[model samples]
Target: LPQTIVDTVVTTWRLEIRFLWIGSQCIIQDDNHDKVIEISCMPQIYGNACLTILASRSSSVTEGFLHERVISNDILCAKLAVKVFDQTAKIAHLIPQRKNVELEPLYRRAWALQERLLSSRKLSFGSLQTRWFCREMDDNTSLKDDSRDGWTFRERKGWEELERFELLGHWIKIDSQTADELSTQWYFLIDTYTSCEMTFEGDRLPAISAIAQRLAPRLGDYHAGLWGRNLLSQLMWTRVNKSKLAKDATPSWTWATAVGHCRYTDNDLTIPAATMLAMLAMTAATAFPTKISGAASAVTLGMSVTATAQAMETVTPCFILATLRCWFTLLKY
Candidate 1:
């Protein structure tokens, strides 16, 4: 373990936290089997924690986050002398703004994305100042307000909303409005997550597995990072830049197979008529094996109609077809 992390453990002890679960210290690094088990349990580990400590300033494990921060002149308030009723008085006004947490090295890591989202409470040791984040409230040592514009605030709101819906567990009762909100949040997550940097390309799926598991109850069946319920809309993702396909077993249809950042289409919530027909046809084809012959014909027709619709909508037809083919192939097994 790094000295900084060791010091943090001591700090936790001082705070009367009985136990601290450090990934490096707790998990067997060399054992892939153990790693897999631990990785899957990340949601529980983070979500259940009283508080999660983040070394936001540190670029690497070895670089300690405890170093003194350099504050700017603008942040420091200047004292002013005033005369009120012939009595001298001194006063100062300060407006301490919170630094952008997204710019931090820790926030840029792909694995930390889920960690931040899952943890109910977070104590971030940032470069400018330490900040605290929770579902209900956020505060910093500089006395920053919640009105700040930053990714942390936005993600916190998203997580809180997700928690609210998850607690209710009546998504079907609320209908499309609720489903659309959830779907929109999920796509936003994908947009943010794919933009993060990862050390190993293979860790893409494994790193996000915890998040997937966390959302499974609300989102339904997980199919290569895409939900089965919104499979058609989820398949409408496009790469931000020209990138190579993943050299792994990941399906080419899913964004996980792409090397670079991927973004979902604008109309993720609005399912077109052709897509609806295609989805229904595919669902019938897979759900009822006895009606395969009839359903397969419908599927073929649906696919053709979907391709035409996608082209008309200015979406990549080849991409949609590839996704449909891969989805069908997966359903076969």
Candidate 2:
């Protein structure tokens, strides 16, 4: 085991936790079967844990996170004196910069993304200080000492709260309101997850399998990185930049096949409705040509069909039907 992991174990013991589930130690690395089972159970393990310790400061296992942090001396602090009715009080104000968790080495790892999201409470040992994050509150030890001069730290509470919402939203029961909401959030997650570095291209889907498993109950079916229910909307994902397809068994239709950052088409009217419809239609034709050519073509279009149905309120349904009939007739030939 690496020293960082040993330090983590020691930290867990200090917290009085009896058992610790170290991925390297608990899972049999040599056995593929064991890895698959363990990886699938990640959601349960991390979600149920009382506390998850993150070595955010360490890039690799060899560089232990327990080492001292080099505090910068460039911080500015001002002491002010205020006169009350009878007495004078002094206040020391320290300007602090918020730490960006995304910049952390551990945050870049593909596996760590799901691990962090799954854990209810995370105690991250960052380069700046030891931070505590949970659904209720997020704090850091650096802020406790008011007398300290250099570089006070402020935890990014907004980002932490957003993460908590993302975690909770997945487990919530699926309803009309939550279904679309959660599906949108899932796309946002994919945008972030795909940007992270992965050592093995094949592990892309497996790394996020726990998240998929957790969401499967609410989202219906799991089809690669895309969900089954709103597959047409999900297929609206587009690559951010030029990227190559993965040399894996994953189908080209899914985002998992591409080894690059991708984001969903923003429904904010920035993209023309016609263009969006065309993209959705093309995605359907490419991904499910058989289904698109069959009687269930409108059903397979998912949200695109709904949008067209709404538009039909202004236009004639017969005209639209005839147009689609001609289109499909040509598609068949």
Candidate 3:
């Protein structure tokens, strides 16, 4: 190769490399099957590890944001009690800039919701301060010292209620492993997950697929957005958008058909205590059946209403034909 040609090729290569993002958080995704898989895998990965959002991750942030993040990272009080034999120059004790620093821009993105929830431990640098959250904590607050700088830490009111509820459930040994229990848990998770926004409409299913994968083994089977084993019960979902019809992206029966939040708040997970006896009696013999038919996985009524009337060809054959035509026409949407 000519020397000039080699130099030009090297320069072009460097520019091409510059075009490709090599940042720590860059995600390479496109409109393909692999993109779906990548989106679906995110929840599982986050669920297994910690969700750490730091100031360093915010490349687009200004110097002011960085200064605030640095201030928040400073610990005014020691995390653990210590006995110091030698006293060196002590670190300056600066008060917290704010309780919650502005959350990084990444946190505002819709895709960050699952990552925040599923992570085992999450470290966030807000505009006001930095905080650490874990599944073990009753609340997400990492700092609980009001005694240090006369900073009184008033606990969130909701935390007390949640703690009491969890304690009660623990005492009774709620069936956390049973199918019924799984259903209740999934209901709560889906309600929260769907409430979060998504940038791409196409990512609707793939984004939540990891949570589905985790529950698939215990949840029987997944059909569209509903469960196959509990098909009858799953039909309880309603269309949120009444004025406009649901999009064809997903089946109308599934909740994913509408872009809205969903909640199943009968106020209790278990059947009412008054009807507990009825729940116990719901054995296979009493279970309602469903029929699976057709190549397109259509479901039909387990027990069909069959009616037959011999056409009175001699009396009113034309009338009978017209009546049948009118009935069929009414069925069209």
Candidates, ranked, TM-score: 2, 1, 3
Segments of candidate 1 deviating more than 4 angstroms? 73-99, 136-177, 267-333
Query: Cα lDDT of all candidates, in order?
Result: 0.61, 0.63, 0.42
lDDT (10s digit) by residue, model 2, range 48-106: 99998999999999888998887555544344466667567544343433245567888
lDDT of 2 at 14: 89
Q: Show model 2 residue runs off by greater than 4 Å.
A: 77-99, 138-156, 159-177, 267-333
RMSD of 2: 9.5
Lowest summed lDDT over 10 consecutive residues: which window, candidate 1? Answer: 288-297
**How does residue 4 of candidate 3 score in lDDT?**
28
Error of 2 at 113 (Å): 1.1
Cα displacement (angstroms), candidate 1, residue 179, comes to: 3.1
RMSD of 1: 9.8
Q: Superposing every Cα of model 3 onto the true structure, what RMSD results?
A: 15.5
Candidate 3: regions farther than 4 A off: 1-26, 54-110, 136-177, 241-248, 265-333
Candidate 2: pairs in clash: none
lDDT of 2 at 159: 43
- Say which candidate scores most in lDDT: 2
